[model samples]
Target: MVKSKPVMHKAGHLFSFVLGVIFVIGGFLATYLKGLPLIEQGKASKNWPTTKGVVLKSKVASHRSSNSNSSTYSAEITYRYQVEGQNYKCGTVWFGSDVSTSNRSLAQDTVKKYPVDKQVVVYYDPQKPAAAVLEPGVFKTTYFYYVFGWLFMGPGILMTGIPLFRWLVRVGRGTDERGENVAGKF
Candidate 1:
């Protein structure tokens, strides 16, 4: 009984690892591409000038309890505006340190800053006017996500591709030699 060498097993592992990495990269790219554009489009659409809106409601929702003493809050805001001669009401929950005066003041300040029935500008997508947000500045933060995404993605693809290429070269050479061996045996 001849024992098969472990090269074939390693080759399979290399192939799987490369494919898995590509799958992850594809997923990230898809998400990043889809998300980045929406952010940009939303920001650009804001340049069209905000339509005046009447604040319908404003409240703070506790997102998480931190250290049992402090908690994170999300600002829930709703407003009514007219789009294409029709009235519409849209609301969104905005979170993050930038949404507030200070990190510690996230929920409280947000709720207080924009009070109910306050007249303010609302930014909405012209194509889908129903999808709107009270805080349009959220798009600015997308720059960081874009930077970090490329940073990790570039290296990940390189690391995965190099090993797979080497494995393919080895497999090709092995198959060529094996075929010669069989021809000689016959």
Candidate 2:
């Protein structure tokens, strides 16, 4: 009787290792890109030019969704400032570039900080003078992206580590190259 040599396939292990590495890198990349804007805002807050601006309007704009009776509020503020003898008006208070919010109190609090006719320190981009903001800071919501990134990366690391640990420990007693135990097979 002739015995056939068992084929040792490593495709499954290779696939898992490759996918795990991709997931880890992809999660880190997504998180890093999401944080770049916040970082830029931080740097802008410190370096952007400061000028005097007068609040033309300040109120919490309310919106009601058609699907439900629930309403949302957003801080709608407008301010005017002069840069190099040119008049400019802008509505951005921070770099978030959006004002829609489900929380009314938070929006109201933001509105209260810049009451109508109140004078505020405006930060303006030197190259694009029209772009301006009353407040220079990162949004609280950005932290969620960081948390999610770590969440995704954690599982990816585990997926990669398990196989790697198995390989490193040389726990391949009677196991095929696929990293599966074959001792109980026959």
Q: Whole-model Cα lDDT per candidate?
A: 0.63, 0.77
For residues 8-79, what per-residue lDDT tens digits would candidate 1 score against the true structure? 766776676777687558646744874466456555654545688898888876655455666555567778
lDDT of 1 at 14: 69
TM-score of each: 0.60, 0.56
Best by lDDT: 2
| Stretches of candidate 1 exceeding 4 Å from the true structure | 1-30, 65-72, 92-104, 135-140, 144-159, 168-186
Off by over 4 Å in 2: 1-39, 142-186
- Which 10 residues in a row give candidate 1 its minimum summed lDDT? 93-102
| Candidate 2 lDDT for residue 129 | 87
lDDT string, candidate 2, 108-151, tens digits: 88888989999889998898889887777666653545566677
Task: Give the number of colliding residue pairs in candidate 2.
Answer: 0
